[model samples]
Target: MTRESSNPKPSPNDKIYGITNIKSYVPLLLDLDRLNYDSWKELFKTHYIGYKWLYGTLTQSVLQSILKPNATAADVWKTIEDLFHENKETEAMELDDELRSITIGDSTVMEYCTRIKSISDLLANIGSPVLERNLVIYAINGLSHKFTHVVTTIRHQKPFPTFLEMRSMLTLEERSMAKDHSRHVQASHQDNASSPTILTTEYQNRPSHYRLNNTRGRGGGRNQRGGSRGGQNGGRGGVR
Candidate 1:
């Protein structure tokens, strides 16, 4: 007892002795759905160097998934890494599918292009950036049927347009379509204004035969008036 050394070895469980729940110390939770693994990892890196501390930061589902009997901290850490790695692939594919499935219905050209660019940016964050050319194609593919001509022009161009160029071209095409539609509406209105205004009730109630006979009667009356005026002029000339 008198030969005890001044320096003593620390117990293996020294780090975990006072810790009851690891999660209470951590400020945030790890959520796969929100894609916050990066933040969760950064916060977790500060605490205990091993994976056991991660059990506190993780959600119940994540904790349950990595839990194993007699599993070491290293084993748990590897499992977490593997799960996130697999998740990245699955997320990338799902994002790519979302990109391909987008449509430009009821959205302006700028809005549609911005939406696509946003998705591409997200993909890049996940280490799966979409090629610029493919992005252009994706934007073109999502345009409405009315933009078929613009899509064709973009596809046929040599040295395909950049994403910004494509967006500008689509915006111009949208304006052109809007102008054409406006002009067509104005022309339609003008035609309506110039046309005869038939009373709906009278038109619906009158028979075809009655309208025909009325038109003929009006023509006969005009002819009779002209004959009477002519005869009166001839009589005046004879007297002269």
Candidate 2:
């Protein structure tokens, strides 16, 4: 058999890093390093594959800044690490600010929660992990005011809600509130459509002469009482 057919070609999928998942790409690089250590040729081939993956995934600006004419995989990996590692603090702070400023406005409970968790993951990767309790607090604080009742109820309960518990409760509560609001709006529209005609019809059905008489009777009752009091005062003056 020919040595040319000794080894199978690497898969095309293996030529790409995690793409949007840079965190996973680092560990994969480490595993590749360990596996190829026994042979320089295999190691060089692995590095070349990694370089290709990195080149394909990186933006044009990033490629221009970091690309070396004859760079190995290790060289590309080290350059990426150095560039990102130097700005760890800045990255962490930005993540922290994002977490702090996140709100449930215009986003569903699930979306808001996902964003919070994403920021938390980024912070952890940057070495400034948020504690579970603090994360829970941040997530709750970012909720819309409609959740205040649910939040207050949860806080008052013993053993306080876990992050998962809070998330579940908030999601359920959001759905419930949405349903209630929809029902209320539908009912209001129905009431408006049906009630206005009934009210107008009732008013129109009443005799106009009867309404005039009723209005005059109420006014005359007040005027008659005043005149009676004045007549009694005049009678008392005459008796004096």
Q: Model 2: residues >4 Å from true position, as ranges?
A: 1-65, 195-240
Count of backbone collisions in candidate 2:
0
Q: What is the lDDT of residue 113 in candidate 2?
A: 86
For the record, the alpha-carbon RMSD of candidate 1 to the native fold, in angstroms, is: 9.6
Residue 45 of model 1: what lDDT?
64
Error of 1 at 220 (Å): 24
lDDT of 1 by residue, 214-237 (tens): 999999999999999999999999
lDDT of 2 by residue, 48-68 (tens): 455775665455555676789
Question: Cα deviation of 135 in candidate 2 (Å)?
Answer: 0.9
What is the TM-score of candidate 2? 0.57
